[model samples]
Every structure is written in structure tokens, then in C-alpha cells.
Target chain A: MGPVPDRPATSSRTPADRPATASGPGRVLIAVYAIFAVAATSRAAVQIATRFDEAPVPYALSAFAAVVYVLATFALARTGPTWWRVALVSCSVEMTGVLVVGTLSVFDRAAFPDATVWSNFGMGYLFIPLVLPVIGLLWLRRTRPA
Target chain B: MITGYAIAVAACAAGVAIWAFVLVVLHREPEKPLLMGVGALEALLAVQVVISVVMLIGGGEPGSMLTFLAYLVGSLLVLPLGTVWALAERTRSSTAILGILCLTVPVLLLRMVEVWGGASA
Candidate 1:
């Protein structure tokens, strides 16, 4: 291979110049992820601080969901294969968390006396929590490199 | 919580959401008028935040003061942050972010009102 052309500095690049996950509808996904991150983190923080003893499982799950959202949002906003893998893992975990928590919360109400971001498959969130990960996974697949 | 004011804020937010989606349907960017609408809604939200602060200072309480305060900050910041994110992309979907934020503000507002009611109870 001939000498590679001089690489432009990374700092000046726009989202348009980055990965597919940073453009168009992907940005909208990022916005949604951000909202959930903020909502879940704050909710979990308050729950844990105020009443951890009352319901540790659900509150802890909220924090975990918030972290996954945060990770996915950050990964999608950045460029590179590493971040892509991170985003994929985060979304997978999010999907599993919602399904498992949702199922358990429904059949075993005593276990989740309190609600979580994933309780009832995110029914409280209009099922966005349940729906978002599936969409995210699809988007990731659509944008994947050959 | 200011009962009538809360209603007004929620209505205004819903109105903004509808307006943003209309822009999307028309294939238009967020125009100045739409931004102004958000600005007006932001001012109304500010009033709600002010009332909350006053309540706390005047020995009023919320069921969970921490939760209430966090929602107050989150509700106020959504519009500004969403606006920035929209402008960053400058695409049709960018405009959609405004709609999402507009929708979120009302939910946040409703939660705040509920928290305030809890405190008063």
C-alpha cells in the first residue's frame, strides 16, 4: 500500500462525518437514550437513597437500566468499532433486562412490590423501554459494516 | 404547585409537541416561531420552578424533596438541551428532537405536580 494521506484531526469532524449511528434518525435514538438515562438515574438515585430497605431489587435494577442507557447513548454518539461493540452489548443487556424483569414483575408481584424501568416490560413507560432496545438492535444491524 | 399554572404549562407543552410534528410533516426545520413557542413554555416552566423553591423556603414539603428537585431541574433543562442537539444535526430528525423534548416536559411537569401534592398532603 502507498503512504496513507495525512489524517485530519479528529476534533473538527461533525456527526455527519462519523458512524451511521451519529446521523439522522440515530441522533433521535441518542436523544431518547439520553432521556431514559437521565430519568432512570435520577429515579434510581432517589429510590435508593430514600427507601433502599423498602425495595432493593427494583431500585437496583433501575440504576442498572440507567447505566446501560448511558452506555448506549455514549457509544452511539462516538465513532469506532469499539464503541459499536459497546453499543451492541448495552442494547442486548437492556433487552434482556426488560424482558426478564417485566416477566418476573408480572407473575411475582411480591418480588417487585415497587416498579422498575423494566417492570411489566416497561408498561409504565408506554412500553418504550421494551420497544426501544428492539429498535436499537435493528438500527445497529442496519448500520453494521460489511 | 400552582394548579391552573400546571394545567397551562402542560397544555403549552402539548401544543409545542404538536407544532413540532407539524413541522416534520411539512418537511420544515424548526422555524423561529417554533423556537419562540418553546421559549414561552420555558418561561412558564421557570415560574413553576420558582413556586417550588418558594414552597420549600416557606416550610412547604414534597413527599420526596430530592426527587421533586431533580425533576424540577430536569424539566427546565430539557428544552435547552434538546434545542442544542437539534441544531447540531440540522436535519429533519433534528426537528423531531424538539417534539420529543416537548412531549417529555409535560410528563415531567405532571410528576412534579404529583410530588407537590404529596408534600402538601
Candidate 2:
């Protein structure tokens, strides 16, 4: 309700004085990540539970993508050098997963009769899966401990 | 899954989504009106959940009942959770988070409708 406080000054004063990963802009990022985490996890759960036999590869990949998103969300929310490193690794892996799975799903339509979160670079999820890790890596870089 | 109700919910969500975006553009945090709007959307979602449950119990079997129920619960959750996250810090980013939350409602609703219709057919 009060006037927006000046944030850049405080953030700049102590480069080592990094805010918690869940604070400020990071909060928004984490929220988005949390959404994806829930979405992918649930979708994977349902697919694997009910119809894993139909498309095991895509369903398993969905589960894998869910796990990665969950880890990324957790690592991004935590504070510390270790957690930061974990986030970096998780996002990198996520980037690689999306690209690889997305490409495969695109060129070999027969291979993906069922869509995973990374199918076609997450076209089903509005391409957020494709873009989220990029933003996450940038955020992690900006917030890296100095 | 009801068409009229879905449309109503989407309209409410769109109104709040725009309000949240305007707050972000103006570099303002979410204030009372915005929070109230979220609260209103939450109320609508709650109503939706109840209606959905009633329909399910009344032999309105969706194609995948578990999936439909999960989405119903998820739709009810997003606004409250997003509001808590947004209120944790009063900043433009917080407002932007609210906007994103608002936008998610319609997507969830649309998916719910798809699942419902898919089951009925």
C-alpha cells in the first residue's frame, strides 16, 4: 500500500547482499516455476497411472520433465551458494531436455502419440517450458553471490 | 464445465488480469481493490468446484474423473496461493505475478472444459 521502495539502490549497495531467491522479481519467477512444477507433475502422474502402456516413452519423459521442474523450483527458492549452483544445473538440464525432447517430438510425430510437457517445446503449455529456463538462468546469473 | 459459468469465470478473470497488468505497468503493488478482485475470483472458483462436484455426483461422469477433479482443485488454488506470494513482497514484480495468476485461471478452465467434454463424448 505504501509507495514502492527504491530497490536498485539497496540491491546495488552490497553486491554480496543478495536477496532471497523467492524475493522481488525472483518471487514472480518462482511462482511461474511452481505453476509448471504442479502442472507437469500432475499431468505426468495421470498419464503414467492410467495409460502408461499406451505411450510409455512420452509418459516417462513427462515424469522426468516434472521431476526436473520440481527440482528447479526448489533450488530457485532456496538461498545459499549450493542452492544457486543446484539451480544453475537444474535449469541447464531443463534447457537441454526441452530442446532434445522437443526436436524429437517434432521430427518423429509417430514417436510422440501422446504429448509430454516438452513436446514440441511445450507448445501445449504455451511454450513456457521453452522460455522459463532461459529466464531462470538469467535470473540466477544476476543474483549470483558476489 | 458449464458453458455459461465458464464464460462468466473467464470474464471475471480477464477483468482482474487486466487490472493486475495495469498495476504492473504503473509500477504499483497490488492494493485493496486488486486483492478484492482476486478474492472475488477465488469465490467464483469455489463455486465452480462445488458445482463440479455436484455434477460429478449426479452421474455427470467426465471422461477422466480424477483428472477433472484435480484441475478443479488446482483452479481453486492458484489465486489464493498467488495472492500470498504476491503479498509477501509489495513490488511491481508482485503485481506481475498476480497478473500471471489471473491469466492461468482461464487456461485451467479451458482445460477443464476440454476434459469434461472429452469424457461426455
- Return the top candidate by DockQ: 2
* Model 1 residue pairs with clashes: none
Against the true structure, candidate 1 reaches a TM-score of 0.90
The 10-residue segment with the lowest total lDDT in model 2 chain A: A6-15
The model with the greatest lDDT is 2
Runs in model 1 lying further than 4 Å from the true structure: A1-19, B119-121
Residue-wise C-alpha lDDT for candidate 2, range A1-146, written one tens digit per residue? 55575243344222467676666888899999999999999999999889899999999999999999999999988878789899999999999999999999999999999888899999988899999999999988878877
Name the fnat for model 2. Answer: 0.52
Off by over 4 Å in 2: A1-19, B119-121
Candidate 1 residue-wise lDDT, A16-107, digit = tens:
44436776678888999999998888888888887899888788888999899999999988766687789999999999999999999999
